[model samples]
Target: MASTETVKVKVEFGGGTELLLAPPQDKRHSLTLPRKDAAGTETNVTFLIEYIRKNLITEREELFVDGDSVRPGILVLINNSDWELEGEGDYVLQDGDEVVFISTLHGG
Candidate 1:
């Protein structure tokens, strides 16, 4: 396993939001994200973007907001295009690439 010291992640949310993530002090290329739902609860999920490869994220893997495992309500944008309309997990990520996640809701 690579040391968590070398991994870095950049996230961009809906409406041009963005954040830069640094690897945990003790690990390389490892990331843990926290989430709180409407009920005011928190959940921690661990994932490494460097591990996102052709095998792990096949063309069939579902695209969720922030690449999160728990919340699949939102959609991810690849190269400024929607994965659902273009291609889902089939969209491979390249180094120094840009991906965005946006919220989804039904309204009239």
Candidate 2:
């Protein structure tokens, strides 16, 4: 069924992902986003990416995201499980779910 409720989740950034956000470059975010967007479709990872890009990211959008997904070399995990295993962008978010982004492209 279509989910229309709001979902509270924890979003985290690592592997230099925090550099794209505003200072003091906090990596953890507690967000409440609609379960269904303007089109009334369930809010999933794909939707969350757009929402974050528009609302949370301060600059360098191209570095954090590409197209409708994370740029190549960025790793996404939901509730500690790889996003690919959870249907990638199609995975429906659950309340209290933890989403993490790590950029593998960064050099130490």
Candidate 3:
């Protein structure tokens, strides 16, 4: 069996995305996730997204997740850099990395 190491990261929500959490008020969280996935591969933002959807999101999952990544209109930032510059969902998380999710779509 492969040993699982944990990575700790800070996640923040904004642009109304904070309202999607269970409490709907807590927008920041320090999360611990396995460094390796079940397949014994290094985990990435994709894994983290699933983790948040499963463990943090309480309802209206569609608002947060669309398939394997976040739904359209949600911007992702890693360590203050646009996730697109960091390879988006493919970026391997580092300890203490700051991940921010901001939703750009909102009801008018």
**Native-vs-model 2 lDDT?**
0.92
- At residue 24, give the lDDT of candidate 2: 88
What are the clashing pairs of model 2?
A: none
**Tens digit of per-residue lDDT, candidate 1, span 1-108:** 533323223345542111222222111132222233234433211232323322133332333224533145556665567667644554433333355555464346
Error of 1 at 86 (Å): 4.7
TM-score of every candidate relative to the true structure: 0.36, 0.93, 0.92
Better structure of 1 and 2 per lDDT: 2
lDDT tens per residue, model 3, 1-108: 323488888999999888878884688999888999999878899999999999888889899999999999999999999999999999999888999999998787
The lDDT values for all models are 0.37, 0.92, 0.90
TM-score of 2: 0.93
Ranking by lDDT: 2, 3, 1
For candidate 1, the TM-score is 0.36
Clashing pairs in 3: none
